[model samples]
Structure formats: C-alpha cells, structure tokens
Target: MSATTYALGAFILLAYTLEAITGFGSIVIALSLGALLLPIDQLLPVLVPLNICMTGFLVSRHWRLIDRRLLLGMILPGMAIGTLAGYLLLPYLDEVSLKRGFGVLILWFAGRELWRLQRKAPAREHTPNWVMRLATTAAGICHGLFASGGPLLVFALATTTLDKARLRATLVSVWFSLNSLLTLAFLLDGRLVPALPQVLLYAPLLLVGVWLGERLHRRIDERHFRIAIYALLLITGTLLLVGP
Candidate 1:
C-alpha cells in the first residue's frame, strides 16, 4: 500500500475507536481527515459501510437501551425524508464546494462545542421538540450529503433526558439504520462494488478500534475526552478549510 493508504487506515482506526466510545463521530472525524488524503466521493462509500459494521455491532449489543419511542416518533421520520432528499441532490453538487462548506460547518460545530466545554455550562433540561425535530432532519440531510451528521444529532440530543449509556445506544442505532440506507443507495448507484476492496482491507482495523474503544469508554473521563475530540476537530476543520 502507498503511504496515503496507511495514513487513511490510521485515521479510520482512530475515528472508529472514538465512535465506539461515544457512539457517534466516526464518519465526521474520519471523513474530515481522510478527505485531506482522498476525495470525499471516494471516502464516503467506504466510510459509510464501515460505520454500518461498527454501529450494527453496537446496536445489537445495546438494543435494549434505545429509546424506541423517540426514534420512531421524531428522529427517524425527519431523517429519512431529509436523507433521501440529500441523496437525490448529491449528484448535482460540486465536490470542492462541498468539501469547503463541510469544513466551515465542522469548524462552527467544534468551536461552539469547545466554547461550551470551556465555560462548563450545564446542559439544558429540555430542547424544544421542534428544535430537535429540525436538527434531526438537518442531520439527515448532512448524512446524505457527507455521511457525517453526528455533530448535529449529538448537539440536538445532548439536551434530552437520556443518560450517557442510553444516548450512546440510541445514536448508534440511528447510524446503523441511516448508513444502511446510504449503503443501499450506493449499491443501486453502482458505487459500492468499486469500494468493496478498500472496505474489506480495513475490516480488521475497524474491529480493533471497536475493541479498544469499548474498553476506553469504561475508563475515560467523559469531559476531558470530549475536550480533546473537539480540539482535534477544530484543527481538522481549519486544515480542511484552507488546505489544497
């Protein structure tokens, strides 16, 4: 393999491990960093399926913790509609524009999250239902467009009543379902076949990431880990926005 391939594998391992711990952020982190090495179009097909594999495992293990009512009643419907709409529109979008726009979005999210963390603001008791609905729907559109919608969904869910375990379980379930849809879309559009080899090549790395992350999830301080993650994201967003 070339150096770029090795670098991408490292990024994949790091990203998925984080997701295993947090139940979200694999694609956003992986895609953002990987896009610096490879094109977004190529990376999404591979990253989405890998996400399915990881999240599928998580969902199966934590199915009992999922808030089914919230998922079905509010999150799923909005995301489903938005995802399909974004998928349909993907072919018309310009790749460079997409990358830069995604960078800006990530930057804003990371900066806001870091700011919140720095101030140690208490999470809100309730996010208005309409706001959550809008965020999830928007998250779906982002997933369809970039396969990196966890930030929005996470932001929306942070204010909810679910505790850490339940929230992580629910989020992974969301990724498993949405990414499956995205995988099918890729199959129908003739993109999956071409990406299969790369997907297969990285399977072991994904498993290792999950194993390590699950262990870390049990030991790490949540606040500090989050601070580190957003810090990395802040730098990544800067690179994506300015790098050639």
Candidate 2:
C-alpha cells in the first residue's frame, strides 16, 4: 500500500480504539488527523459510518449505565434543532472559518480543563441546567455541520458528578442517536454508498483497535481517564486550528 493509505489505516485504528475506550471521539480524532491525508469532503463520508458503528457497539454494551434523564431532557431538544438547521445550512456555511472557530472553542475548553487539573478542584456536584442546554445545543450544531461534536459535549459531561463509567456510557448514547441521524442523512444524500468500500477495507484494523481500547479502558483510573480526554481535546483542537 502507499504511504498515505498506510497512514489512513493507522489513523482509523487509533481513532476507533479511542472511541471504544472513551465513549465519544472517533470522528474528532479521525477527522483532525485524517484531514492531513485527505480532504474533509472525502474523509467525512468514510468516518461517519465507522463512528456510528463504534458508538453503537459501546452503547449497547453499556446500556445500563446511561443517564436517561439527561439524555431525554437536556440533549435531545438541542440536537433536534441543531441537526435540522445544520442540514439546511450545510450548503451555505463558511466551512474554513467555522472550523477555526471550532478549534478556538475546543482550545478554550481544554484550557479550562487544564486549569482545573492544576488546581486539583473536585468535579462539580451539579452542573446547571442552562450550562447543559448550551453545551448540547452547540454540540448539536457542530454535529450537524461538522460531525466533530463530541469534544464540546465531553467537556460538558466531564464537569458533572457522574463517574467515569456513567460519563462514557452517556456520551456513547448521545453519539448513537446523533450519528444514526447523520448516517441516515448521508444515506439520503447519496454520500454513503461510495464510501462503503473504503470503510469495509479498514474494518479489520478498526475492530482490532476497538479490542485493544477495550482492554485499556478497564485499566484506566479516574484521574487518568480525564487526562486522556484532555490530551485528545488539545491535540484535535490544535490540529483543527492549524490544518487547512
């Protein structure tokens, strides 16, 4: 295989593994890194299906841990609005500026996370409803527009009182619903079929990565789990900011 193909394989492997371990981030990791090898127009179609499968697997596997209250009350409304608006606005949106703005948002959140880590402050026992609404709304818009919405939602979830398991499970549930919608949207628009062959080609490596990530997930402590998340946000955000 060519070097670019090899890099693509490697990126998918790592990205899927991270998603399996962390609950929500395959697209964020893949798109941020894969953009180096292929244009977003091509990379997004391939990654979207893969993201749904990954999140679906995790959600099913961890179904009992999901916070149904949060999912129904706080996330769905914003997601519904954002998805519709995003689908309608996709053709007219200024993608380059939007991506840079996305990067700035992520970096700002990452900075806040780092500050919290430095101060050793405890996670908040109660994240306000207004904050949850805003985060879910922004995540929905990003999900609808860019398919890279996990970090913003993750940032919001990380602040709550949920333990690592609940947090990961809940995030997976969100992705499952959002990505399912995205996958269907892509299907109706005829973006899914042409991408399937490439997605299948990478399936073996992706499964292997998921298996490895599951192993790592069991070993991660709470502190290290948050650290892993922050690391991903920092890397993905910087890449989005600097990439074309």
Candidate 3:
C-alpha cells in the first residue's frame, strides 16, 4: 500500500477503536487524519459511509444517551442547507484550497479545546446558538464537499456540558444523518458514485482501524488522557492549503 493508504487504514483502525471505547473520538480522529492521508476526492465518499455506518452503530450502541431533539433542531437542518450549498460550490473549489480551509478549522478548534482543558474550564461554558449553527453549516459543507467534517462538528458540539457518552451519541447522530444526506447528493452528482466500490474494498480495513483505535481510546480514557486532536488537524489543513 502507498504511504497515504497506510496512513488512512491505520487511522481507521485506531479511531474506530477509540470510539468503541469512548464515542466522542470517532468523528474527531477519523476526519483529522483522513484529511491528511487521503485526497479529499477519494476521502469523502469512502469515509462518509463508514462514518455513517460506524456512528450509526454508536447511536444504537449508546441508544439511551442520544439527544434526538438536538439533532432535529440544529444539526440536521443546518447540514441540509450546508450540503446543498457545498454541492453547488464543489465544482469551484480546488482540492488544495478545500483541504487547507478544512485544516485551519480543525487546528483552530483543537487549539481552543486544549486551552480550555488546561485551564480546567468548561469548553462550552458560554457558547452561543450562533456558534452551533455556524459549526453545523460549515461542517455540512465540509462533509458534502470532502466527506469529512467530524472534528469541526464534534468540537462545536463538545462545548456542551454533556458527559462523554452523551457527547459521543449526539455527535454520531448528527453526523450520520448529515452524511447520509450528503451521500445522496453525491449520487445525484454522479461524481463520487464510481468510488463506492473502492470504499467497500476498504471496508474490512476500516473496521480493523476502528477496532485498533478503540483499544487506544480505552488506554487513554483509563488514564484520563484527553488532549486536543486538532493540532494535527490544523497542521494538515495548513499543509493542504500550502500544497506543492
């Protein structure tokens, strides 16, 4: 496998494992490394379905913890609009610009989270509705355009005081719904449809990745090790932006 493919497969193994142990890490880790290793063109379709599949399992696995009303009220609708807009803008955005833009968002959000964790302060102590709306809209666009937007959405929602379990459920529900719809749009466009088979080819690897990530997450959670996954996200996003 190519270095890029190795990175992607390895990421799936580890990220999925963490999510299995602790739901919150699923989207955050999946998309962060995904943006770096896989070209967004290939990355979006491949990852989105797996995300929906994995996150859906998470929703079922943690059924009691999900916040249904929140998904209905904020994320779903925002994603609908965002995805539509993203599809419209897709032809106009070059890969480098899109990846770079995504990278910046990830890094910025990750930095903020790490800082709050340091100060022993609540990340969502006073986050506003506008922030959530902004996050959902932007994330929807990212997902529609790149099939990866977990870190941004997860970070935005993580502001709430919901416990880790609830946080994971909420994030999963939102992403699954939004990504499902985005996939539909991609089908309509006929651009990413051809890649579905390749996505399936990687399924087993993705599953393995999730399993590995779960193991890592368990160790980290047991030690109460919570660090921002965004530093890498930002750096990658910047790299994408400053591409050769």
Candidate 4:
C-alpha cells in the first residue's frame, strides 16, 4: 500500500480502539484524521462500513448494555427520518452551508459542556420528552448532513442516567446501526459502492484502530475523556467553517 493509505489505516485503527473501548462514537476520530489523508467523499464511504463492522462487534461484546428503549425512542425515529432526508438532499447542499452548520453545532455543544462544568450543573436529570425530541431531531438533521453529529447526541446522552462507559456504548451502538442503514441506502443510490475496493483493502487497519481506542479509553477518566472529545469537535467545526 501507499504511505498515505498506510498512515490513514493506522489512524483509523487507533480511532476504532478508542470507540470500541469507551463506547465513544468513532465518527470524529475518523473524520478528522481521515481528512488529513483522504477526501471527505472517500472517507464517508469507508467509515460507513467500519461503523457497521464495529457496531456488530460491540453488539456482540456488549449486547447486554444496549439500550433498546432509547434506541427506539430517541434514535430510531429521529435518525432514520433525518438520514433519509440527508440522503435525498446531501448532494445539493453547498459546502459553505455545510461548514457553517457544522461550526454552529460544534460551538453549541462545546460551549454547553464548558458552561455546565463552570456552573457545576446540579445532578443531571433524565432527558425530558421535549429535550429528547429537540435534541434527537437536531442530531438527526446534523448527522444526515455531515455524518459527524455525535457531539449533539453525545451532549444529550452524557447528561442522562447512564454512567460514562454505558453512555458511550449506547451512543456508539446507535451510530453503528444508523451508519449501516445509511450505507445500504447509499448503495441503492449508487453514491459509493464503486470505491469498495479501498474499503476491502483497508479492513485490517480499521480493526486495529478500534482495538487501540478501547485500550486508551480504559486508561482515562470519563470527564477527561469527554473534554478531549469536545476539544476535537471545536477544532473540527472551526476548520470546516473557516478554512479556505
């Protein structure tokens, strides 16, 4: 393989490890690093398959932890509709709009977390119906647009009853399912399959990355873990919005 491919493969494998272990979604890790070496067009297709495979692995490994109710209540309806809309409209949205939207989403999420930490927001409450309704819908809208909407949903999930590890698992699992569905839809529309050769070629690196991410997750505290994620989101959002 070429040096670029090898490097990206290693990068993806490391990202996967973090997602696999901590239950954090891999979209940002994949999107940010993959951007350095691969086109966003190519990266999206590659990540769909990786997410599906990783989800399958996690479902088997942590099936017991999966939150079926939340999956159905918040994710399934909101995400499915949003993805369908994205699939239909993604081709038309200008890059400029996408970047601006991404910036808004990132700043909103990051700023909220920082505010929460400073205010020492009291013991978190269950996701109210209205909050879930709004957050899930917004998350769906963003995910459909960019395939990088984890921070929105992550904010919602982080404030809930589940502990850090379980929260991660649930979010990642939902992401896996959503990506799998989106991939099949993309295949039907013929937007991505022609590139499957690269996907097949890079499979090993994907798996290795998941392994590493999982290991790294175990070593860090959850609060710190989340801060790192928010920091990355901030950087990604700004670059996408303001970069030439």
Query: Which candidate has the highest TM-score of all?
Result: 1
Tens digit per residue, CA lDDT, model 4, 114-223: 66766778766677777876777677767777676677677666656776567766777778878888788769877668868877886777667666666666776657
Q: State the lDDT of candidate 3 residue by residue for 21-129, as single tens digits.
A: 5554554466667766666666666666776777776677777888878778977787778777887888898877776676666667667766766677744565689
All candidates in order of lDDT, best leading: 1, 2, 4, 3
Question: Would you estimate the TM-scores of all the predictions?
Answer: 0.98, 0.87, 0.80, 0.84
RMSD for all candidates, in order, please. 0.9, 2.4, 3.1, 2.7
* Candidate that beats the other on lDDT, 2 or 3, i.e. the better one: 2
Ranking by TM-score: 1, 2, 4, 3
Greater-lDDT candidate between 1 and 3: 1
Top model by lDDT, which number? 1
Tens-digit per-residue lDDT, 103-156, candidate 2 = 776677667877788799776766788887887788778777778778678766
After the best TM-score superposition of candidate 3, give how far the Cα of residue 32 lies from its true spot, in angstroms: 4.7
Candidate 3 Cα deviation (angstroms), residue 230: 3.5
When summed lDDT is taken over every stretch of 10 residues in candidate 3, the lowest stretch is 221-230
The clash count of every prediction, one per candidate, is: 0, 0, 13, 13
RMSD of 2: 2.4
Off by over 4 Å in 4: 1-7, 36-39, 114-124
